[model samples]
Target chain A: MALDGRIEQAVVAALALSKGADAPPRLQAALDHAVFPGGARIRPTILLSVATACGDDRPGLADASAAALELIHCASLVHDDLPCFDDADTRRGKASVHRAFGEPLAVLAGDSLIVLAFEVLAQAAGDHPRRAVDLMRILAQRTGMPGGICAGQGWESEAVIDLAAYHRAKTGALFIAATQMGAVAAGQDAEPWEELGARIGSAFQVADDLKDALLTPEEMGKPAGQDAAHQRPSAVAEMGVAGAVSHLKDILGGAIASIPSCPGEAKLAAMVRAYAEKMTPVHLSPVRG
Target chain B: MALDGRIEQAVVAALALSKGADAPPRLQAALDHAVFPGGARIRPTILLSVATACGDDRPGLADASAAALELIHCASLVHDDLPCFDDADTRRGKASVHRAFGEPLAVLAGDSLIVLAFEVLAQAAGDHPRRAVDLMRILAQRTGMPGGICAGQGWESEAVIDLAAYHRAKTGALFIAATQMGAVAAGQDAEPWEELGARIGSAFQVADDLKDALLTPEEMGKPAGQDAAHQRPSAVAEMGVAGAVSHLKDILGGAIASIPSCPGEAKLAAMVRAYAEKMTPVHLSPVRG
Candidate 1:
């Protein structure tokens, strides 16, 4: 199967475990609502791409890891949209999980997804126990505190913020997990894959900053100019749109070059380049010029 | 070391990972506040006790498993107390995580603890990969959907509640995890331990219902009459005071009889008996009689 197909199948299979007949219908429905019609699916795609590049000897583990990473991302969005957080009314062109399912079910759904992510990994661990354990570690570290998305969010509540740490954790953490977990899933050293993910993550963050600064809410699907509205530090805010665009190109270019020497390094490079093109299309190329 | 000491040490060590210097200070404080001076530490204590009864060969894995179970329990309490859920002002006799650190941090702290629970198990998985995988599976199944604590909470949002499923998923889920995970950590079959956990969990639920109905908020150290206020179904609502007490006795007695044949069967039975005594003390006997 292609990456998207495989990703969808993995997600479906994993969610089936949570959608048993006995499950409370609303919570189960909330899980579906949070996940399906996913936005971009960039993280899981990156995970599978890396896994494939590294041989993907254990396809089941790789697929589960990819799905697990994406589930964490989705779970974060659910919590992020709660009334206490961003209070986002819509996401991915639809009502946010909390908006659609009510706050209590949304919270349970997010919590359920987090647990289900590990369950997915654990279920696939039977044949390749070590790889599964590694995936869980990476997922946990990237999803939780100190240097994870949760920590990234936690930084916002602090009086003093570390901009670099904030961006690295808020977005870079999962991308790093994507690359490292993908490599580990395919029996490769996770350390060698970190730089590639970090560069890609930086590129994506810059692109997001540019889009938020330049695009309207209609163009972005969800609310736009949220960075300025919330007074959040952003690449565009720190270094003008033109500068952010230039920096994005630099990061994406570095991402392609950072691919560790693997059996399919060329293929992975091409994939990253393709993503870069999508993130920074021809229309915006002349904006910096 | 004693069960309490081991449980505390394991929790501290596991949390230390998330409490690194780089962590957001308030978030770190929230994590500590959510866990410290814990109520009875009963879940972890039960886990350690079961592990002991089954010959805790892998002491590290058992300790980590015990802590992980308790963290899940604590994480549930944090979310359950959220304004979106219980809208509670206090938990464990202190301002709830949300009340103390605000809603966003409370959400993150709960999330961080959940990830940390899986990380705890993963960190200790190196030596006993199979056992660790088993532990993870059990934890996930008991903590997430259809049969977990999250599912238990999900039931509350439904129009028609299945009381058995609600009770099973709610209080019974973690108790089951404690017993089954304890057995798995000790390299025993988890299936055999389910009955003991279910009965014990049932007993605890009945005891809780009785306390909520009979005790003052001052005695309970938190709000009372919540079940009546919310109009939620409970053993007390169904069976009244005397009937609920009799039912509690039946369940606890059955729990003792349900202990799976193990090396430390006698000791395990004694521990359950001690817990039952504490749960149903002398003062309450006359009210039911």
Candidate 2:
């Protein structure tokens, strides 16, 4: 499927899975509101691409993996916007979940999304129990641990931290899970794909940092530069903005190079190049303007 | 195996599994601290009893199941104590995790425990993939729903709330999961044990409410009366203290009645009755000269 088609399919499926039975009407509405008008499905797209490259015969399983990872990403965003975290009033050019619903519901909503990610994986990993279990492990590690996204958030409170560890766990972990899960779904037993995922995942995090430091909220469709407010470390913190950009290109190159051993490496490389070009500092200006 | 002996063995094993290869020193230390000096292993005790009553031949499986539920409960307590939530300074008469380890590491510690709960279950249910999967579903629902404990906290912000649904989802869900997991681990079919679990689960929630409202922090080893501070509804809210006491008896009776259909029903009932009595208002009073 085309990247946009994959993104659309994943988003719809993810939103559908989060609805609760006899749940507070506001919780369901808030989940839909946070998911709609859509945030970028960059992670899921990468997942789908990697799965396809790995010879996945089951498109539905691939879609489910993609959707599951995206739900986790979406959940982190909801929590990241809470008053105690980024304290942002808006997301995607609209009211943040906490602002739209109350803080209490928003917290629960974010948490529910996190749980729903696992639920989606459990229900969706049909005939791939082992892969599903592996996916759960990878996702859980990213969502919870030292270098995981939760740890990434926790790092904000520290006076000092390893910048590389922060970005890798906070942002890169989910991306890695996405790529790994996609490959696992495709029944590929290859090792190179994991390294490819880590490299690409890091590249994506660097790209996100570049956008946060350089792009407008309008361009990103989410608050920008809020990382500085919490005194959290970013690539832009360690490296100058221009230096971060160069580093991002290098990361992308490494990610692409790691993929050649897999089948259809060129197509995956092309996808990386196109996405990188579209998301770089130069491209962000027109969207902001 | 005796219930107390089973609990001791399970606690040791569960804590041992907390280690990770790439775990940060601070995160690891925080985890150790959070789980050690364990509380009354009440939920697990109840779970093991229920499992034994249900014809579970292996006591080891019951221990594992109980440990998983306790880990979940402990993890939730850690998160709930964060500045974003209760902002408590103490738990079990010691420094709360965020107070001890700082906010970031504390958060990661809690997140780790939550993931660890599932990991424990997944590892234990190695041969019974279906039962293991079902355990994940049950815990996931209890920990992350409209009526889940997390959602129960969210209900504090609503203008009106459903006491029964909130209590059932929050406290009752884990208890239910514990019973069901124990039974499943012991090879009981889903249908009968689920009903037995529901009864015991309701009683557990009522016991928790009794402790929360009527007991002092020194007596309970956690902060008391925070429920009123948050304006959240409780069994105390829907029914008077006397009514809550009566409700506990009724729920316990139902739980015991459901047990006669299973093996070792009398012993299980006796243990449950003893536990419920120990948790009663008079039993929880602060000591006096």
Which parts of model 2 have CA positions greater than 4 angstroms off? Answer: A1-11, A14-17, A226-242, A260-264, A281-289, B1-21, B54-64, B83-85, B102-107, B123-125, B208-244, B281-289
DockQ of each: 0.85, 0.38
**Candidate 2 residue-wise lDDT, B71-184, digit = tens:** 878877887787766788988779999899886566557667776776666566555566566666667766765545666566555566666666666666777776777677
Q: What is the TM-score of chain B alone in each candidate?
A: 0.97, 0.85
Per-residue lDDT tens digits of candidate 1, residues A1-289?
2799899999998898897777888999999999998777889999999999999999999999989998999999999988888898988889999889899999999999999999999999977888888889989999998889999999888899878888889989999999999999999999989999899889989888878887777777767898999987888889887788888988988888889999899999989888888888765554532
- Residue A196: error of model 1 in Å? 0.9
Clashing pairs in 1: none
Task: Write down the lDDT that model 2 would get.
Answer: 0.71
Candidate 2 A-chain TM-score: 0.90
Residue B262 of model 1 has an lDDT of 95
Q: Which whole-number lDDT from 0 to 100 does residue A166 have in model 2?
A: 67
Pairs that clash in candidate 2:
A147-A169
